[model samples]
Target: MAAAKEGRKAPSRKSAAEEQLPGIEDARTAFAPALSGALERPRSMLRALRFRPPQLLHLEGGEAADRVALALWWAALLNCDDPEVMEPRASAMGPCLSCSSCLRLGVNMHPDLILLDGREGSIKIDDVRGLRSILGEKPHFSRWRVIIAAEAQALGIEAANSLLKVLEDPCPDTCFVFTAPQRERLLPTLVSRGWVVTLPWPEAGRPLAEELRPWEQALGRFVSEGRGWLDMTAARNGMDAAKAHQILLIGQKALADCLAGREGGMLAAVFRRMPAQALMQVDELFVECQDQLQAQVSPLLVLDSMAARLHILARR
Candidate 1:
């Protein structure tokens, strides 16, 4: 996040979610009802509302775009105050896109909307302390103070302990949202406290979230097609280290699903065509890639190793 300053004007460089992103509309649609509930009967709902309309939300799974879009959208809806209504309204109408709050939030320039990117290393106690200090203040204009945290799993032990205090007695006007690749990444106590809403996979991959990116989809196709000679050069070249990591994860899941009698289902052809022993060896290599990624090894080298091994396996 930009430096912790009072009444800070949002930075010119915006997060991807600030711009109108791919899955943002879907996010608005998905969470419209909750926003509407907040607005429709604020008095009634507040007295009766349980955790369903979550004060603290754990947005798990989905692409970076999907998570960001949803988080920003939810924040905008909770804060929008435009009196205008759209034609042919949704059952749970969201923020009027034309409202000042909506416009500001669209660019993440809202004074009350805070976004915290927990560093990959760790989100220490000081970071949470700063956040608590900020939340201690009242919203400048919007009714709700919103904070969307990405990579929240990195919250260190002390930070997590401090945050638990806030969660136990949350501010009435404050809402918190967390987005992580996997739910297990967060501590169990934190996960248990928030309402976990698994956002749908990016439109590119539905149902099982399979076929997320070009390389991952191709990896799945190659495995299922079971063509021993399937060229992996395109998939290999298209990925950077991060993308390659995702591709390997998808490949690993495919192998596991196939082994568990999903042979004729998701990866039917690939499972049938590939030798069991060869697939197992490839799976082991992929696991090694995962360990290397966590250990901060060079991604290209990891991918190159996997590709070479797969090539040799195919040749055999």
Candidate 2:
């Protein structure tokens, strides 16, 4: 993506027509419960700002769209002029959607809200430098300047390091928010600098597939019945990187479902028998496999490696 132009307001990546379309407003109602739950930490931090507040906030584990919406909601709350009017019980409960700050943020026009979107392309070093320049100035219209880097996993290494420098010595009254499929997708050093808020996986949008049954059953047996059931050769044959990644995701969802106590599936039944720590290890393995895939590792090698490691876990 191109670097944001220098000014109080970084030029919006969205076209005028796209900005006019309903976004965070619709997301607020559609994802009310999830948004409310995710906002609790940031809300508390905002209430205790006299103490050290996290300069960087990582919103992880949700649909990318939902993460962005939650970030926007948090931004609104931070800048809202009348949060007390909407949330009478607690002044910091949430944003008053009608406040001037909230209104501009709702439509992505807030000058203090700078968005460095990496969804369409890699966020480059120039983008981070441009953002640094803008952040050097004070908030143009609100108590806080919020920078939302949506799909931050797409930030190139150089750009991520550049942003990391900003995070290390963050501008006063500035907050940096990052949204990603998982915090593991970001550099560990970068993730360490932020406060991570994990959003629940949206129930209706969790990836599902009828074709996943066979794979799920296979995984269940491999875990339940031991290494004899794992056929790495067969698993690797004819599989491409995309399909391998899908299988890992499917496995992850099953493990997550089992942990959440959502019942009645083959994988869930098998996963439920394992200790919670073992289940977590399996999930971490899936993430590691995904990282390898993203690094252009061969699908066969990744699958075979995953199978061997899973078999060792199954034995435990």
Q: Tell me the tens digit of each residue's lDDT in model 1 across 83-148.
A: 321212332455665555676666566778877765334456787778777776767776668887
Native-referenced Cα lDDT, model 2: 0.69
| Model 2 C-alpha lDDT per residue in residues 53-79, reported as the tens digit of each score | 368888887566678877787777666
Error of 1 at 77 (Å): 1.1
The models' CA-based lDDT, in order, is: 0.58, 0.69
* TM-scores of all predicted structures: 0.54, 0.57
Model 2 residue 15 lDDT score: 41
